[model samples]
Target: MAGMDEAVAELAAEHGDLDALLAGLADDRWLLPTPAEGWDIRDQVSHLADTNDICVDTITGGPRPLNEEALKFPTPEAFTQSGVDKGRAMTPAAVLDWWRTSAARNRDVLLQKDARDRVPWGLGMSAKMMATARMMETWAHAGDVRGALGMEPSATPRLRGIAFLTLRAVPYALSYAKVEQPAGTLRADLTYNGETWPIGPDDADNVITGDALEFCRLGIRRASRAQTSTLKAQGALAEAALDNLRAFL
Candidate 1:
């Protein structure tokens, strides 16, 4: 429960950050297209608002059918675009309010969540895993919004939560490619701002070492392994996981 409180608090802080970022955006900025291809700021908020409700439902009860359907979309892009069509009827302010409402509910869930709770995120994950995924996702979309507005994403320790999730997802990453996970321990060492954050066994020969932000970016599919040229892998499985890592698959 100590860790749950921490993860929940981190998630809450990130959500507040995102809400503040959008709260001051002008109407025109709301219409700006983000790094998510066809999605504008409004669409991004709509997606999160919808997913926020799903997150709370997963904890407090169950996700609605529409939300459940969105999760099953064949591609991440498709899933993001699914709700925007009908959502277009709503004003930007209305949409933002909708997102805020769900986010509020999510914050409540964060306060009350326990370790035994689990959400069917990606390939079935625990409540803490769900919170981490939500935090990473909100952070990623915030980057998209910032990119659209010609703003820079502020480097922060909060990113470590996402980075930690990426490091812990090694097995899931390998499974995505159906790569035969090699036997033996695997290690990943991430260096960010002069500090080295390591995961897996220190004695393991097989390792993936790189920038912490780059590793988190890789998990969200924001940046590819090649783009983060700093990353170096010493084993076949580690390399394979690096190539195919995705926060959601």
Candidate 2:
């Protein structure tokens, strides 16, 4: 809750960067494929728009039924594809409008809530946690958009929220993998903006130190544990955590 102010600001900045990235596109460009296989620009935005509605609903006390049919799919990727296929009927303009409006309202509603209030997120999380999750999603998918446009991602202090959340979620990640917590407390000695940002228990032997973007990439599953040489670890839990971490649920 303490970083709520900075987290909200960074979320806004992320959306702004996305807007700048998608400023102009020929109609054909909107139809082009992105890094998410089987998804084009419209599908990517459509997914974001759909989730925006869910975010709003969570805060507004109007929960909708999860798509049971989609849940029947064997994998999360398949579940997503089912929705993206149905969303194909939306013209790009309509999808873009929905996303823009929902994102705006999302900011407004969250700004009015107390940090401790529960938001019906993945499994009931704090308002600040929800906002941080939104930032993670926004930044992760924004990469797909950039890939489609052949542009490099630019970093900002906004990543601070994502990095913090990634480190904090380590315990949950261990549970998700059903792995026993390694024998000691954990620590993250990450560096962002040329300054080291140390977090977690000080006496812990587990340490993960690296570039913020690369660590963020690991959480988003965009990069593998073996591929991120920039990420260094010094304990059992740290090694396993790096391999199994997730920024997105």
Which of the numbered candidates is closest to the native, going by highest TM-score? 2
- Model 1, global lDDT: 0.78
Clashes by residue pair, model 2: 219-247
Tell me the tens digit of each residue's lDDT in model 2 across 193-239.
78887778888888888988888888887788888878998989898
lDDT of 1 at 118: 59
Worst 10 residues of 1 by lDDT: 62-71
lDDT of 2: 0.78
C-alpha lDDT of all candidate models, in order: 0.78, 0.78
Q: lDDT per residue, candidate 1, 29-52, as tens digits?
A: 899999888889888888888778
Model 2, C-alpha of 215: deviation from truth (Å): 0.1
For each candidate, what TM-score against the reference? 0.89, 0.90
Worst 10 residues of 2 by lDDT: 62-71
lDDT of model 2, residue 194: 88
